[model samples]
Target: MSISTVAKKLPTTAIAATVIVLGIGAVAPVAQATVLTFDDIAPISYFNEIPNGYGGFNWNNFNYINGSSPKVRRTGEDNGRVSGDYVAFNGFGNPALVSDSVFDFNSAYLSATWNNGLSVTVEGLKNGATLYSKTVIVDTTQPTLVNFDYFGVDELKFTSFGGVEPNYLGGTGTQFALDNFTFNEKATSIPEPTLLPALFAVGTLSIGSVLRRKQLNQS
Candidate 1:
């Protein structure tokens, strides 16, 4: 094609490239799921604090219970363990938190420690903004399987409320058990769809201009 003809078509070519880039940007990446069983955390005495970086997250007010401990019957620590002898619980009957990069909260098993019909509120957050929140009730004898399916969250905060206090248990509070916590990791900071087209337009136009100049020089 003539140089002038190519020059006239350069913008059109760039626009076409921009369309392709925008299409790719519009497509989100497939996420891979991860399950945190909390069984990997070993227990010290009857329970141990879930340290920072457990299952790629920062944990607060969480501890792993040793079901085999002598206090299991009195404390009801073994009632909720699904995968192993250990299950996580909120320490001091306070709110608990697990945080990391963006991820989807899929599901988990929940149970009450010293009470029945315990109310638990779980909130998903990103950048200090709440994205998802749900309250669930669990039993002391059996665990409730809760499917959250919350997406694109960086933090999961849990708070417990009123429940029937059991006089049999040595300790009593709003504590709940957590096991088999599942989630899907999300790619962070993807290019905005609106910005993709402009970036691709500049790149495509620069490459086209270079090719056009080379052809003119050869002629």
Candidate 2:
């Protein structure tokens, strides 16, 4: 009945935490996310015509996070493909161009180009569930790549998909031309969390001083 009554009978909606430092056991360590391809922005680098935040990734709806759609960088228009430009979303409200860090997602590789076909899933959230998913479809005119698979998460999402069809590459144009999208990050390096209580209190005082010097050398 201890351990806080087995953690109050557990089950608090997916709680899988662990940290037994003295014996060494921790998690959260994977790495990849940071592969967007608006083709590095430079088409003019704007504050005037929109489309800004590049590598670090950003773009929140209504016009870029709480402003009310007067406009603010959604990386739209320009239209090309994986290597040329790519970055446009406006499939109406299901917008997602985020990734300023926080990722443990497992597999991805993309190049969307959809329009009336409306297709694209790609999610990997945490704290909000939905570990990973993948859907595809691209009307086909350009922009391809597209791949999916996920597990464990930090948060990665992309929406719009009218029932999976274009498995990897093809296109239409209701406006959803993303590109080069790739994810992997979960590489948590280790040794931090405030140094795990002084490294588990110096490994529980060096195993209780080697079990009291082996019971005082067996008396």
Report how far residue 157 has shifted in candidate 2, in Å: 17
- Among these predictions, the greatest TM-score belongs to 1
**Best model per lDDT:** 1
TM-score of every prediction relative to native: 0.71, 0.27
**lDDT tens digits by residue: candidate 2, 1-219:** 354444344433212333343323455464546565444444433222225454444555412121112232222233224454334444453656454456544333333333434576766667777766777765434445555645446556677645333433342344455545566555557664543454344445556867899999999
- The global Cα lDDT (0 to 1) of model 1 is 0.82
Q: Which runs in model 2 stand beyond 4 Å of their true positions?
A: 1-23, 28-40, 45-114, 120-133, 136-176, 179-182, 186-219
Clashes of each: 0, 21
TM-score of 1: 0.71
Model 1 per-residue lDDT tens digits across residues 21-123 = 5663465667678888877775476788998998889999998888767787644467887887888999978999999998889999999988887899999
In model 1, which range of ten residues has the least summed lDDT? 1-10
